[model samples]
Target: MKIFNLFIFLFFVTTLSNAQEAKQDFYKRSFIAYEGCEDSKDLERCYEISFHEFLAKHINRKALKDSIFFEAKKDTITVSASILYDENGKVVKRHSRISNPASNRIEGLEYLLDSIPTVKPVLDKKNNGVALSTRKLFGFYLNKAKDTIVPIFGYTPSEVPYEIIEKVPVYKGCDESMSNEDLKNCMNDKVVQLISENFRTNLAIKHNLKPGIQRIYVMFKIDKKGRVKDIVARGPHPEIEKEAIRVIKKIPRLKKPGYQRGKPVIVPFSIPIVFAVSD
Candidate 1:
């Protein structure tokens, strides 16, 4: 009787999981098209290119000059904002939120998103207009020595290069007194150890992956608060990618966040998980 009851419980759990998955599939993200991206086969890529072009054309350089921090801080500043598209394709800047607190100090970005021109309405799989959300990140490195600014743009503001960070984030239990290079190596080693212990190496066998080397590329950010955020993974199989993300999210908050020019800043890290599958 106990065995029968256990079977029933597992059956119920499986049924519930499948139901939830179905619901998620029904509400999956829809394709979004910017003005120039309307007929592009790769809408996402096209939209990014078009959006960057728009920013380059519309961003007010004069307003940026007004920000005192830009001239004084001599550090890289990154700002991110959400862009919302209603069912009818209208930009609702008022409803969008600026994510970073430092964004408030940049005069140029205050109204930068408000100038977003209308884009083609997004439609769901059923051809019904649906609301969509997108994000943009603007960054500029202030070269105090050169007395100039270098502009950078990407999908996320926290996607800063690892080599560019002056101080890499410190993993728990790692000595903070180590040199910057040593600290970086220590943190990476710890993270890799965590992944190896937690990631299910048997996934390749279960998924029937080809008998060869397989790699999963993962990217995430250690935010200014020293907590892991924005985990993304890509692999041959969805299950493998999901497992990679799970292991990454299990990392504990660090002893200290990364620093640049004496100020805490977001640090982006990417790692590849490679394994060999047997025949």
Candidate 2:
């Protein structure tokens, strides 16, 4: 298996506001008045960054350690949520659906939401605080090795690129004591080898794909714990894509997670796999 350039888009519904005037001009749209973002030149981006930072800091990670959401070797948890603010800029209502129904009633989440501070609501052209309703996508990565739950906020949260991260994730069997460059090379080689060994090439013939090179774009995140999560793939055929995901998911947990500036960070990766089909 040969690996090539990769790109990842953390697709999620970040902003779903009911402000009617926003349709007129996107750049002029009013953003929620998160503290310290009121004077930002780019208000929307600032709000997103500030909001994600708040969640990551205040979400009470330790309380989630024993939650059912992280059970059964689960590496990622996602939530589809709506937060409503009254004209007074208070969080009056909040609704969320977790990825796992078994953990539907999350106490940690309830406490976190309750702790959210009342920010200045987004104002309309009239300069009046407008009642607001917005939907958000939230996620959490389980670092099993450290027994920690890292909160992931907003759509497309900042993820360190592979080439730039201080230390790339090491595969389970790779020698971790090696230099960073060697470790990265070893990890990439291990990934290619794992995919080639596990991927079901016969699926291509079954799907009757054309007798040529078929490219499957695989995207995933290697979390702080070095576990594979959020695997997504696009290919010529649905079955082919499914097989690609299966092969990637089968990868064993890595020995070490990537680090940046002395702290572990989530790393996003995408790989182009060339699958050949035969008549």
Which one is best on lDDT?
2
Task: Please give the distance, in angstroms, between residue 238's alpha carbon in candidate 2 and its true position after superposition.
Answer: 0.6
Candidate 1 Cα misplacement greater than 4 A, ranges:
1-159
TM-score of each predicted structure versus truth:
0.46, 0.44
Error of 2 at 203 (Å): 0.9
Query: Whole-model lDDT for model 1 versus the true structure?
Result: 0.63
Q: How does candidate 2 fare on TM-score?
A: 0.44
Per-residue alpha-carbon lDDT of model 2 for 1-279, expressed as tens digits? 332222222221222344543543432336577788778876656765665566657655455565655564557654434566677778774432222223445555655666667877777666777776654445567677776657665333234556445566788888988766667667777778877677766666566666656688888998988899999999998987898898889889888888755677787777888655544
Q: Tell me the whole-model lDDT of each prediction, alpha carbons only.
A: 0.63, 0.63
Candidate 2: C-alpha lDDT: 0.63
